[model samples]
Target chain A: MATSADHAAPAILNEVNPPELPRAVLVENNRSFTWITDKICGIIEGKTPAWWWVCFIVACFVASFTVAGITYLVATGVGVWGHANPVNWAWDIVNFVFWIGIGHAGTLISAILCLLRQKWRTSINRAAEAMTIFAVVCAGIFPVFHVGRVWFAWYLFPIPNSNYVWQNFRSPLEWDVFAVSTYGTVSVLFWYVGLIPDLATLRDRFMAAGNKLRATIYGFFAMGWRGSNRHWSNYEMAYLILAGISTPLVLSVHTIVSFDFAVSLIPGWHTTIFPPYFVAGAIFSGFGMVLTLMLPLRAIYKLEDLITQYHIDCMCKITLATGTMVGYAYAMEFFIAWYGANPYEGFAFINRAFGPYAWAYWTMITCNVITPQFFWFKKVRQNTALVWILSIFVNVGMWFERFVIIVTSLARDFLPSSWGYYSPSIVEIFTFFGTFGVFSVLFLLFIRFLPIMPMAELKAVTPQADVHGGENHH
Target chain B: MAAQPHGLIATFETAPEVYHAAEKVRDAGYKFWDCITPFPIHGLDKAMGVKRSNVPKFSLTGGIIGFCTGMSMIWFMNAFDYPLVVGGKPYFSPMFAFPVSYELTILFCAFATIGGMFFLNRLPMHYHPVLKHDTIHRGMDDQFFIVIETRDPKFDAARTRALLEKAGGKDIKELEA
Candidate 1:
């Protein structure tokens, strides 16, 4: 009954108007669906490698420094860490800012990139988010201990007490308390929501392998995810909403962090540019840390096909872009200091460049500005060893930047007599250095027990996962 | 009816197979059914006739409550109760209260979104009949499944099996309750 004309298909237009450009495959080597699941889940299922033991032991040894430092300081007073008359806020503030800045890259990757539909983020978001949480843990110690009376740190929250004095809601420090706690809480939720499906996969794997205890443990956390389309319809919406809110949250966290300095009347710190500059530098330093951590991981896991050269290139490009923005901020800060004609501000900028702290300033400039420029070249980004080394420089540079900004401004203030050099004692140095151990210990435990990359997300990006068989995707 | 086999579950090897099968089943006028997949497949919601989630409404409501809480708490503390001015500024201004309110908005919104997702999905269910299939673990890995509940008026043992098999489903079987 059908007409012959209806059965005959129209002649295809062979003349292509717009040329199709090739995009790099997010997951290389044409990995199968099961391969992705097995690869990520295998990390937890397999025996802990020897290097993990070595790293754990070394981390524990280093972590002892923080324990010892805190113990000595608490037994004595905060005075043991070299907080004298002029420089009450020295290494503690610097280390706090540095670690917080390092936390930014993780949220930016997981939230901002996810919103932008950058599929390469799928391979790295899990580890990056974990890094964000751990870095926040490291950053928190400094502020709590810096309060001097660690027991009274609970006063930071808005709780009714006998003192009858409410917190100053107008204060930037109060804003910081709200911002940081919210950032931490929301990040944990986002990370946990993302982990549910992957955890279910782990639970099923363990159930199949006859590992009852592991299955039960994983199943408890998975919250009974059955991969139902009915559930996924809601689950995917939750993930999207989290990503939506998180983009603004990530930006606001750094802005509030910058407010800690900018709200103060300090000459170098009181710039309108601080918010954007700090956010950019945070992302730059964060990517640096990510590269530093992940390069070694990529090699150890042989995840070249999963991670791929394209992901590295994308990260390098973002580092380059953010680094340039930071450099522009530096130039603008100098320009404004001179252009504003404020003697105090001019002197602060001049002192930072040529005064006693010139060495630290130059170290920051060299590491932050010059180091990221190398990523502009194809050869540099492609060379993993070089990229990893540059990432270390980025970390060092960002740290020195915080040190320079804090010390140079406070060390050489308005009064000549009050201006004195501040150097951290051995106790301060050890406590700051010990944070790396805490971060590593937590991170190592994470990679050992949980899926390091998002298996469910990675499967979604592959060609075969496409319901249409992804014929045109190539 | 309660003790009878819970449903017939049809398993498929790939996304496309299951996706097409979902369309066929939906067109067949089955009311109580669902698709199971390792990860969310694009447009599968449309194939299965599922409505979009209403979690955003919960998030918006939560944000409004959080913002109001932040505004009132600051106003009561700084402006009404034991007002002590610091920095010579106004006793309470929305200008300064903005940051805390913004943070609360995000926090409450996130909590509501996640909580609503769980509530809507009826998660933490711990057990379901579809879970007891011999190779059901594959549903959380590479395999896909379409479950037709026995509660549906249109469900018949032989008819559902014939339809699933015709629709390219493999390993079609009834799930134990």
Candidate 2:
């Protein structure tokens, strides 16, 4: 019988084994190492494109509203927004969480995927890391202005005071100050270190072009990198160490952010699962933002071969996976609320779905949970336009998720008499929109001046550039 | 004025070619020699007989300092200086101390890594003897180079040139300091 089954197994195996598909190249167009560097570096070396200026102008115009909003808020007070008695933490906190969550994908690509040896990250990591820095900057702006008096913001730090008052280290808010600042600092350092060799490339290219001014400027930032083996050895080690240290931060920064809500005694906010949920949600929304940025830029820059369909597909799958995790967390939250039989928690979940903020809650569900599920189809994953559109939906959905979480929880408390409706005032709306402007302006400037892709890294991944794999050797 | 001739620089078309040349040069017991490439070549360090970098060790030391600093700062500030109790949590809670400690560890480790890299490589030394060679610019592009310094103990011009030529090196140039 065993022999008979063995004889039958070949037939079954033949049926199960799919036809061999041609392996996809991460860098498309069979681009040579020299071509990779020349093409990517050319973007910075050439005159700034007119569209870049147009986009930059628009971004600057939008970003100016941040100044306007902050001025209005300062001149008046926090009262300009809809932070009433119960809903003290409304749009400001919501936008803060949203932007911070958006920042996570950058580090996730640069650090985590790097550790995993995912070479696909090389194409997108530079831009994504820049996005991370800008997003964190946008994220930082909210909490500072939310303090009502920005000058006293130093009180958040544990600097010794003459009056003998110290910040409470036990508070998650204080932990946020440390976590976010450290994150920002480490990200900038990591980005600059990665940029050095590429900057040197730019310097050499400009020097060859007889542009001494550009060469001098780039050379200053390049730190005189000569690509010496001695330098390469130390540089590689430092980069690896930075990648190792950054990995924990990718998880912890958002976990600590979740702790700000989880440590609270509020019915919906207090949960053990908040950390993982927030992290998954962060990566989910982050990939959404990355897709939104990369899709258009890839088309405009004609970087199709570098930022290939393979990369976009993989990113879509990640968004789908993280979105599914977010959906599961939403379900778990509801299930736990019901299972625990706590009136406040149960009422909070129900109110989020059926009460006054039902529209926001359902919008979050539709955009984040439902939209990404479309990516399960191969065709949908491959379609850039559709993916871009869906990514926008995910962004909108994530914002609503935060809105629903903060507002719905606070809108109706334990006592029915204390229940109140919450809505953002025009100032609050403009302030939130202004952050996008700031983020865009910074990102636009980065793309204009800097090597948006890591030329060295992109070269490293090309076929002929492989040190160990010499099959492509000329 | 013409700069002093520092050494002979030999260019290789491929990584393996350079790796083999580095091995030959290293086996010949040449010190004060260096390989330059557009990117870090795997096994090239072994070929060049390069020692393991102490950057990680510096990072570890920095991380340890950071952990201690984080713990002590929290303890001294919250517990020792002004013991204000909110939410009835412990004054010196290790649980509360961990996030700041973790962030500081990463922060210190990152700083130390970059600092150690620069220190170990003797970087920010804008001028180098090799930079005077025009062909050396390709080292930042798609070329490989091995320069056996004139300061090397085994630096005979004829022997070094012969060794590099035998190792498939092309475009051998005598660079000035």
Candidate 3:
């Protein structure tokens, strides 16, 4: 059945002899460092308009001004913001909890899914990890800044002093300090470790002759990786171990954060369901953030083939699940408020839904409870335009959810004399804006420096990759 | 330096061809050859008569050690070193210990899975005789090929070439150690 044409050795290589170079192929036309960098420079200089960069800058501007407002509030007094006798905690606390909640999906995707060996993760994990780090950075900034005397924030930690007083480890706030700091450190490390291999690949692909200095710098960060089997062996092992470590941390960190509220005997704050409820909310908001970024990202990077419709579909499913969980938590809170027969608890839920801040309540329910249900339709989930719009709505909804919870319950308490409506002052507003700016700047830089997708991981999952088969495939 | 198996390296265009050839070779009573490919071809393991790997057993052992260590540490710390009533709850409450215990189990199990997988596969290794054979690199790309080691007792250069041709191999070539 075979002709000599089939029998003859191919021109590329004789059947008996092959080239020594690894099977690296050029992914795009004009595969040179100079060419790639020039293209990137062109994008920056408006030889090509990086629309995402423009939107990112606009977001940064808005976020920066809000942060400025926060700085002003800190300088003046907590009184400048919406704080009265009983409702001392307001927008600052709400935003603090909201941003922290928004950081969860990143950890879930990068750490949990990595352990699960979900191949689809290759497309988004890098960006998601970057998002995690930035979101956490944003989250960490709030708690520290919200306190009036930001300088003495270090007092939160337990350090030995002449007074011979030790920190009360029993306090949930103390637990929060430890949990958030540990979570941030581990998240950063997890992200950076995963970036090493991909960064090295970029260095090899893009390092220039004259730019050897920059190349060496990026290369050093890349850790002298040569993709040896010995390296991959240890690298993969370490990654798995880190993932294992992060999973419980993901669940615990938010739980401890929730304890900051749940431990208090305030009518609204005290609840057994706070821990799991907060986690579900955090994940729900976090997915909303991911969706906000994913749509434009795939287009900007020309990664439609890599990111695909499948990823968007999967993320929509998660958003819906977590959104429902959060909705359930809301219902459970209302039920417990009634069942406990605690007058203060009953008033807290009643006022939240029907009080002066009822608009925030309605907004939260509409955005979080009603909006995500649209994703149940396969067409809605797969439609990039619709997904993008809904994701934005989810973000606003999640933020409002926190706003409603913090303000409504605290503003109108059992003692009507102490009850007062609260609103964010100018300072509080600026600080929130500035944090968003910082997050955007960091993310834009990451996409430019690193391969937006994990190419090595992608290569591994490809059907033609050796490791996909049994280990002994010759 | 080693006694050579005089045999041809055969490349198949698809996975099924490799499977069929491996099956035929097993039926012909050749135990001195092995097939390698770019990807794991399903059912090729049975066709090649390769035994199941012991990676799972290693991971299980590792997981057990991790779980025990994790639980013991938490018990010793909360029950032994510092016993303070937490929220008026009893010491050694399983709920309080879950985080640390779960962490340990995961730590151990993951370590075992990765370590065992590598060890069982004899990996993290730098040397391979096939690396010297030029065409072997393609095994990671588009083609599937099998080699008869030089040390195999049935190796004969001319007869092996004829056998591979009869087995429907196209463009067979001699492989060197």
TM-score of each: 0.96, 0.95, 0.70
Deviation (Å) of A376 in candidate 1: 0.8
True contacts kept of 3: 0.01
Question: If both were scored by DockQ, which would come out higher, candidate 1 or candidate 2?
Answer: 1
Higher-lDDT candidate of 1 and 2: 1
Query: lDDT of all predictions, in order shown?
Result: 0.92, 0.89, 0.70
State the lDDT at B22 in candidate 2: 94
Candidate 2, superposed: residue stretches over 4 Å from native: A1-23, A468-474, B1-4
Please provide, for model 3 over A16-108, each residue's C-alpha lDDT reduced to its tens digit, 9 standing for 90 to 100: 586676432322232332233333333323333567668767867867775667667666765666566677777677777888777888889
Arrange candidates by lDDT, highest first: which order? 1, 2, 3
Residues forming the 10-long window of minimal summed lDDT in candidate 1 chain A: A9-18
Each model's fraction of native contacts: 0.84, 0.76, 0.01
Tens-digit per-residue lDDT, A220-265, candidate 2 = 9998999999899999989988999999987999999999989998
Of 1 and 2, which scores higher on TM-score? 1
Best by lDDT: 1
Clashing pairs in 1: none
